[model samples]
Target: MQNIQHPMFALSLIFSFILVTHAFLYFISSLFSNSNYWFYFLAQECILFISAFILPNGSPTVLIGLLPVLIAQSIIILKNKLKVILFFMLSYGLYCIAITINYGASELPIFIPIFFLILLIVIVYTISYNRQVSARERMEFYLQQLELAYQKVEELTLSNERQRMARDLHDTLAQGLAGLIMQLEAVNVHIKNGNISRSNEIIVSSMQQARETLKDARTVIDNLRTETLEYMDFHSAVLDEIKKFEEITGIDVEQEIKPIHSLSNLSMEYGIYIIRESLTNIMKHSQARKVKIKIEQKDGKIYMEVSDNGIGFSIKNIGKQTGKFGLLGLQERIRLVGGGLTIESMPGKGTKLFITVPI
Candidate 1:
C-alpha cells in the first residue's frame, strides 16, 4: 500500500507544482498588459516555490516557511476582510500538513507520504461536506411540502363539516318544523269551524315538535363547542342543520347523505355556512317550488350538490346584485376552507350549487 501511495503522491506533487508554476508565469506575462498587482503576485509565488524546494524536508520548522505564500495567495484571491480571513484559515490547513510531515523526521524521506495523505484528506472532506449540505437542503424542501399538504387537508375538512351542518338543518329539523307549522295552521282553521277537540290535539303535537326542534338546536351548539372549528363530526351536524333550513324555508328540501366520517371541523362549518347562504339566496332570488340537496363522500373527498327549480337569474348578474352577500359569502367561506363553490344557472332555469372539499 505504501509503495502504491508513494508513486501517486510523487505524481500529484509534480502536477500541483507544474500547475502553480504555470499559473504564476501566466500572471507575470499578463502583468505588462494588465496591472502591477499581477507582477507582485507572481513574484510572491516564485519566492514561495523556491523556498519550499530549498528547505530541508526533515527540518523541524513551524508554519513560518509556508505562511507568506498563503498570505500572498489570499491577497490575490480574497478582497473583503471576512473572505480574506476564511481563505487564510483554509490555506493554513496546508501549513499543518507540512508541519506534520516534518515532525520527527530524521530526513526528507517522509515528505512524499505526508503530501499524499493531506491531498486525500482534503478531497474526501470536500466531497463529504457537499453531499451533507445537499441532503439537508432536500430534507428541508420535503418538510415544507408536507406542511403545506397538512394545512390544505385541515382546511378542506373544516369546509366539509360546515356543508354537512347546513344540509342537516335544511333537510331534517327544518322539514320537521315546517310540518309542525302547517299542522298548526290547519288546526287554526279547524278551531274556526268549532272543531275544538281536533284543534287542541294539533296544538299539543306542534308543541311537542317545537320541543324536539329546540333539543336539536341545542345539540348543534353543544357539538360545536366541544369540538373546535377544526375537528367536528360533519355528517350528523350537517343533517341537523338541513332539517332546520327546511322548516324555515317552507320548501320541500330533500337530501341523500352518504356515510362518511372524519372531516375537520373548520371545513364542516364552512360547508354548512355555504349551504345556508345558498339556500338563503334561493329563497330571496329564486321562486323555485322544490329544492334538493345531495351529499356524497368518496375517494377521500366530500361533494355537495344543492339544486332548486326556482326562477334563476343571469349568472353574470348574480354577482352584480348589491344585496348578494349570500352568494359572495358562500364563495368566500368555501375558499377559506380550501373547498370550491360553483353555481350553474341561467335566466328562467333552476340554479345548482356544487361544492367539493378534500377529506
Candidate 2:
C-alpha cells in the first residue's frame, strides 16, 4: 500500500475513518445485541495499529484524532479500570515509538499527547464509574417495587380467604342454627297443643339438621387447613345448584350455559356463590313457576343473566337490611373481582338480573 505522506490529507483520512467507525457502532447497536461489542473493540484495535503506520510525514499529530475511539472503548468495551489504563498506556506508547523512530527521542515533544491521554483517561474512568453506580441504583429501585407488589398481593389473598370463611359460616352454621331455633319453636307449639306425633317429627328433623351443620363446619375447617382445595368447574357447580333448587321448590329452570373458557378459581368461587344466592332469594320470596339462567363468555368478560317469572317486588324497596348474604352480599362479592350487577324488577312483573365479571 502507498503511504499518504501529506499532513492535512492524512488528518482528514483519519477523521473520516473515525466518523465511519462511529456510524458502524451506531448501526450495530441498532441491529444487534450488546454481546457483539467485541466486534467494535477488535475493529478499533486494528485502526489503532494502522494509525501508527499512517503517521503523516513522520508527524504524530494525526494520532489525536483517535481520542474518541479510545474514549468509547474505555466507557463501553472495557469493564475493568486497570485494563482501560493499561490499554490506553500501550496505545500511546506505540504512537511514541512511531514518532521516535523518525524524529529521535530527544527531538520529540512527548508531553503533548501524554497530557491529553492522561486527561482523557481520567474523564473516561469517571464517566464509566458513574454509569455503574447509576445502574446499581436503578436495579435496587426495581427490586423494592417488586417486593412491595408481592406484599400487596399477599394481603389481598388473605382478605379474600377471610371473606370466603365468613360466607361459608353464614351459609351453613349460622343459617342452620336459625332454622333449628324456628323448628324448636314449632315443636313447643305442638307440645302445648298436645300434638305429640308432630313434636316428635320436628325434634327428629332438628337433630338431623344439627348433624349436617356440624359436618359442614368440619369441612370448612379442613379446607382452611389444607389451603389446596381444587376449584370446581363453574358449569357443573351451577348445574348442581339448579338441580337442588328444582328438587326443593319444584320450579322449572331453563339453563343455557355456553362452552366457557376455564375461569380462575377465585372467579369461579364468587360466581357460584352469586348464583346460589340468587336462587335462594327466588325460592324464598318470588312465587315464580319458571326461571331462566343464561351464562356465557364474551368480550373478555363472563356474563350471567338470571330471570324469574314470579311475583317480583319493587327494586326500590331493596336495602342493606335485605337479610343475611342478600343482594348486598352478592354485590360485594362481584365488586371484589371488578364486576357489575344490574337488577330489573317490578311488582307482579318478572325480575331479571344482569351480571358481568372480568376474566
Candidate 3:
C-alpha cells in the first residue's frame, strides 16, 4: 500500500508542477509586456529541474515536462534567434542530466536518439509555419498592387469618355451649325443678285440639313442615355445605316456583311458609328457615285472596309484641314476599343478605310 501510494503521489506532484508553472507563465505574459518575458520559461525549466532531482523515481516523468517546453518554443514567435536557441540547448542539457542521474548513463543511447527525433519534428513545424506566414504576406502585397492598377485604369477610362463626348459634339452640333452658316450666307448672296429660284433652292437644302443635324443630335443624346445597340443586332443596324445612306445621297452601295458570331457591345457600337461617319464623309466630300462596304469576322477579329471612288486627298494634309474631324474621331474610337485603322487614299484615286478590332 505504501509503495502504490508513493508512486501516485509522485505522479500528482509532476502534473501539479507542470500546470502551476504554465499558469504562472501565462499570467505574467498576459499582465506584463516585458521584453525579457522568455526568461520566465527558463525559470520554469529550473524549477522543474530542481523538482525532478528531489522527487523519487522522477526520471521518466522528466520527458513529460521537457516535451511541453520544446513544443511551446516551437509555436512561439521567435524574435531573438540566439536566445531561443540558448533556451532550447539549456532545456535539453538539463533533461539529459536528469535522465543520466536518475535512469543511469547506459540509457543515454536510447533516449538521446528519441530526443533528437522529437526536436527534428519541432523544427519542421516551425519552418512550415514561417513559410505560411510569408506566403500570406506575399498574397496581400499582390492584392494591393492589383487594386492600385484597377484605380489607374478606371481614371483613364473616364478621361477617354470625356474626350469621346467632345468629339461627338464637334462631329454633330458644331459642324452642323457651321454648315448652316455657310448655306445661309449663300442664300443671302443669291437673294441680293435677284435669283429668287436659286435662293429658294438654297433655303430648302439648308432646312433639310438642319433637320438632319437635329436628328443626329438626338441620336447622340439617346446614346448617352442607353447603349446604342440595346434593341438592334449588329447586322440589322448596319443594314439600316446603309439604307439611310442610299436614300440621303442617292449613291449606289455594294455591301457584303458576313455572319458575325461574337462581338462585344463596345465593338459593335463604335463600328456602327465609324460606318455612319464614313458614309457621311463620302456624301459631303467624296462626290463618288459608287460605294462599297464589307464587314466580316475572321481570325478572332472584326474587320470592316469602306471604299469609295471619290476625289481623295493626301492623308498627311488631311490632318491640317480643320474641318476634317471625321478621320480624327474615327481614330479615337478605334483606339478606345484597342483597335487599329488604316486609310488608303491619294489626290485622285479612291479612298478606302480599313478597321480592325479584337472580338
The most accurate candidate by TM-score is 2
lDDT by residue (261-292, candidate 2, tens digit) is: 75766676677778888998898888899999
Candidate 3: regions farther than 4 A off: 1-76, 79-83, 97-109, 147-155, 181-199, 222-359
lDDT of 3 by residue, 1-359 (tens): 32465656675667577658756776666444455656666666776777676663754565653554454553464456776677777778887888888888898888788877777776787777878988999999999999888767755654575467657966999999999999999999999999999999999999999999998887676345224475678888889789989998888799999988666555676777888878888988887988999999999988999999988889997668877737887788899888899999997898999999777
- lDDT for 4 (candidate 1): 55
Cα lDDT for residue 127, model 1? 55
In the order shown, the candidates' Cα RMSDs to the true structure are 15.4, 9.3, 9.8
lDDT of each: 0.65, 0.74, 0.77
Comparing 1 and 3 by TM-score, which wins?
3
Question: Between candidates 2 and 3, which one is better according to lDDT?
Answer: 3
- Please give the ranking of all candidate structures by lDDT, highest first, separated by commas: 3, 2, 1
**lDDT of candidate 1 over 81-186, digit per residue (tens):** 6855665554445444445554533433454455445545654664566579789999999999998998888666655655676566566677787888899889
Query: Against the correct fold, how does model 1 do in TM-score?
Result: 0.39
Task: Give TM per candidate.
Answer: 0.39, 0.53, 0.46
